[model samples]
Target: MITLHHCPQTRSMRTLWLLNELGVPFQLRTYPFDRTLRSPAFLNLSPAGRVPALEIDGARMFETGAITEYLCERFSPDGLGTRPGSPNRMQWLVWVHFSETLSQHTAALTQQHVALREDHMRSPIVMKLEAARLGKCYAALEARLATPDENREYLLSSGFSAADISVGQAVYMSRHFATLDDFPATADWYARITARDSFAASLPNDDGIYDRDFYAPWPLE
Candidate 1:
């Protein structure tokens, strides 16, 4: 059986969402978003001590994108993945991995807003800059979803796939730092995809890294 080591409201949630959509029976091992990841036992699962360490077929895997590709290819290639030689293959790969681009900025903002305990420990500039960068990522999604000739409800032309799950979850994290107000298409797409039962199943039942729904940028002096 597959096992996923996860933390709520982190990149690992992306993997959880994918697993839910795949409908595979798997065990979930959740941990707090803290130094527990540094424990030797956890480190053995993920050398870098990340939340999304996967145990499958007696092998270990890290990196959200790699795990997404492997799982989809192995279990639901046609449903959640666009295999090689398929028409949407290139676009599929692009959007599936592009989630990291958005997530990197969210990780930065998370560190600034959630990870730092004291106000003095946080950098206002970093908060503002990372939040702005998340807006830029939102803008990119807005453009993609607003394609003139297409009614693009999902990321791919073919239909919903892991690419949506990947990027949608990134947007979920990004929303705390940046609002989707200006990006109408992105907001709509986000709402549409997140409405899925699979997305709902992936959500945390308890408190997560962020205490609030939104984390506004620190005000300048």
Candidate 2:
């Protein structure tokens, strides 16, 4: 059985969601984010002291992007892991890179988190820049989703793919971007994913860490 070293309501949740989507039975070796990242055992699992590391057949893996690809490749071959020469294989390749590259938006959300923390050193000057940068990113995302009229619900190709997973999580997580009502396509895309029974089973819906308040960097603002 695979063992996923995860923390609640984090990037680690993606791995859990993937596993759940694939109907794979696995162990969730959960640890608290509070000081757990630095623990010797945890560091052995992930040198970066981050969540979402996975142990499969005794091999350890880190990074949500890599882990998501690896899990999909190993378990969901019919879904995300097409061979390199195949035409659809490009989808996985595109999303693996797209997910990582688009992390700028998520970082903006993170900056909001740090800024709002009572002890964090967040200056209004920094927030102004981040808010501006995030605006640009959101606009780009808006344009990217404008393809395929108002009916389709994905970033690329039909139905859901790793692309949707990457973008869905990012957009759902980017609360500060404001009024998802403006991006109906992306909003509709995510609603479908969130409604998936697989997603509901895997996601930590009860975890306060993933709560709206947690993503809000309001106090500092």
- TM-scores of the models, in the given order? 0.97, 0.82
lDDT of 1 by residue, 97-195 (tens): 999999999999888887777888989888988999998888899999999999999999989999999999999999888999999999899999999
Residue pairs whose backbone atoms clash in candidate 2:
none
RMSD of 2: 3.0
Q: Pick the candidate with the highest TM-score.
A: 1
Reference-based TM-score, model 1: 0.97
Candidate 1 has which clashing residue pairs, if any? none
Worst 10 residues of 2 by lDDT: 210-219
After superposition, the stretches of candidate 1 with alpha carbons farther than 4 Å from their true spots are none
Error of 2 at 40 (Å): 1.0
| Native-to-model Cα distance after best TM-score fit, residue 62 in candidate 1, in Å | 0.7
**Least accurate stretch of 10 residues (summed lDDT) in model 1?**
212-221
Number of backbone collisions per candidate, in order? 0, 0
Where is model 2 more than 4 Å wrong at Cα? Answer: 102-104, 111-116, 148-151, 176-179, 210-221
lDDT of 2 at 102: 46
